[model samples]
Target chain A: MTATTDQTATAATSAKLSPYKRFTPTRGNFELWSWVFMRASGILLLVLVFGHLFVNLMLGEGIHAIDFAFVAGKWSSPFWQVWDMLMLWLGMLHGFNGVRTIINDYTEREGTRWVLKTLLVVATVFTIVLGTLVIFTFDPCIDPNSTLSVCTK
Target chain B: MTATATQPSSDEQKAGAVPTFTVTLKVQRYNPEVDEAPHFETYEVTAHATDRVLDALHQIKWEQDGSLTFRRSCAHGVCGSDAMRINGKNRLACKTLIKDVNPDKPITVEPIKGLPLEKDLVVDMEPFFDAYREIQPFLITNGHEPTRERIQSQADRDRFDDTTKCILCAACTTSCPVFWNDGQYFGPAAIVNAHRFIFDSRDDGGSQRLEILNDKEGVWRCRTTFNCTDACPRGIQVTKAIQEVKRALLTSRF
Candidate 1:
């Protein structure tokens, strides 16, 4: 009985001495939605990616058809423009979330994780913004003597 | 004594004619009282091919060195007292047969990782048990206790049958790379225990356990490495249990 009592006392003392660090309940379902989004976006990306590839590389003239002129002609239409935009956004977000999960898995220290994640956010944002601008602002006829039908019209 | 030039060939050994073979057991030992750092000590023992690793350890401790230390209670796999890193993998020494591991080469033995080593092949199990207790691994139901037992359907019991086999062996937890790096993560064993209670249809405290595991150091830390599943001596699919908990968390939140 005395040994049992001593053991209980020791357990109580250690429990008090080393309290578990309490993390406040996160405010929202960020991780849950992040988990869901990865799956949903992945499915959508498959169709958009394959369709884009088929149109550019297989539908008409195959690999030889892919050039600046082909790209410029495709981006001229709003249908292809929206398709490309969705692809860009979904692809970037999917890849970024994957890298974030990897970072969280490997990095142990708080400061190191913070530094790596900050760099990741910056890189992701820059690429997405630049890609979106190019998809929307692309023009094959910037030159004054351009011969393209869209520029002449 | 070393084996002579006339040692039995493979066919004779397989036919049960060979009485014994010499095995070199290289054990990583650390004593807080004497050692500055852990080191390996080699011992050669004559043993039948079918003898368990625990038996070899016993021969060394009983005859070779009086101070050599390790923990074993039932000396069977049930008690889970002798979980160790045998040959660079987490396994219960009592369950691993000598022949299963290549005894011709030196079989390495060491204490499980991610815990404070107390002495030779023994670690302080307080942290592991503390995590177990933190999950409130007990039936918590609301209202007055039923005079009769809380009845559960056969299907309901089957839902959690896989997780109930966990012996609280630290093998799965210690094998995890995440647990090796961060002590706070509620390693696979704790999650497996939580799963046992969580999926029980009779338990009402699942949401509470889910909330606790929903913390940053909870189920999200699992990288789906499957090391825990491979290390489990009880054949528990540890990674599947963890994924189930992760899915439960997602469904509960939304």
Candidate 2:
């Protein structure tokens, strides 16, 4: 028999011979999903990432246009605000899941894994909270008495 | 009479011709309740040409002693169990054959370093999972459901695809020297996971996750030993992911 057939036969025989089995991973399926995800996300990333670059670099006065005032200008508009918000959320999730895979593959200690992942979640949350705050609560033109330049603007 | 006797002896020797080879296995054994200190136990097992170290362990457990214990879920190398220090290197016990480790000399097997040993070859895994969950490894969109399916191109998914293969085995994390001393350091595996979505186009939490990782124990703690990469069973390019995150942090105007 061919190798494929031989493997099939062996599997069949093993199944017949043994009734109690514990935690046999359904191989090939997880990998298949991961492969599909890479292609799909990679394409979306090209658009979102490149669009971000183009707008920041080529739009209006281009790279020279960027400054504290420029950022204030973009955040002021709801359209740009939504666009940036989407970029931040998507990029972090994708990267986080990807690294999760890396962690599962490498770390052997159960305690260590738990500790490290917990830290990752805490940090991720802290950043998201702080960043969203900065994005939303941003004050471009502040009172003249304020110490910050952006606030002074 | 002498010739007859010699011939008979030679025939008997030939009839019981089983080549006996001796292999010494030095294993580290620890029991907190029973033993005051951890000690090494050596076993000499006579194995065949096709015997693996796992097989030797079985022989030792079965014939020599029964107190020896280690974690083994799948005899095959899939479930991420059986990872241990084999001859001073991190590898799965079931995947490494005896001949490959040391053909003539004794082979040493110990629990992975940088963790508290619960018993023989079993380390506490709570800390490792803590770091994993800390990264918030989930989709956190603005709760705005798309009218249709969230459309993403093939290339967008491909950017973080290689990184998603991690199995959370802790081989990479324990292998890290930084984690050994600085428990607060996020370690390589957590950073790699954070980088996965941080760079993804579909996900939106980049700046948020980046800010979290930018802390003292975050991505900056990575010394780039490449031990996490080398020890990973899945062949993940861990160092590259860390570098990518570092680049993202540097270039972002925010």
Which pairs clash inside model 1? none
Off by over 4 Å in 1: A1-28, B1-18
TM-score of chain B of each: 0.93, 0.83
lDDT of 2 by residue, A40-88 (tens): 6777777888998999999889999998777887898888777777677
Write the residue-wise lDDT of candidate 2 on B148-206 in tens digits.
Answer: 97888899889988788876667888888767763556777788788888877878888
lDDT of 1 by residue, B1-254 (tens): 13433564655444334458899999998886689999999999998867999999999999898788999998889989999999999999999999999998999999999887779999878778877888999999999989998999999999999999998879999999888875667799999999999999999999999887876678877889999999999999999999999999988866
Off by over 4 Å in 2: A1-153, B1-22, B48-51, B147-149
Q: Model 2, DockQ value?
A: 0.02
Clashes of 2: 94
- Which candidate leads the pack in lDDT? 1
TM-score of each: 0.87, 0.55
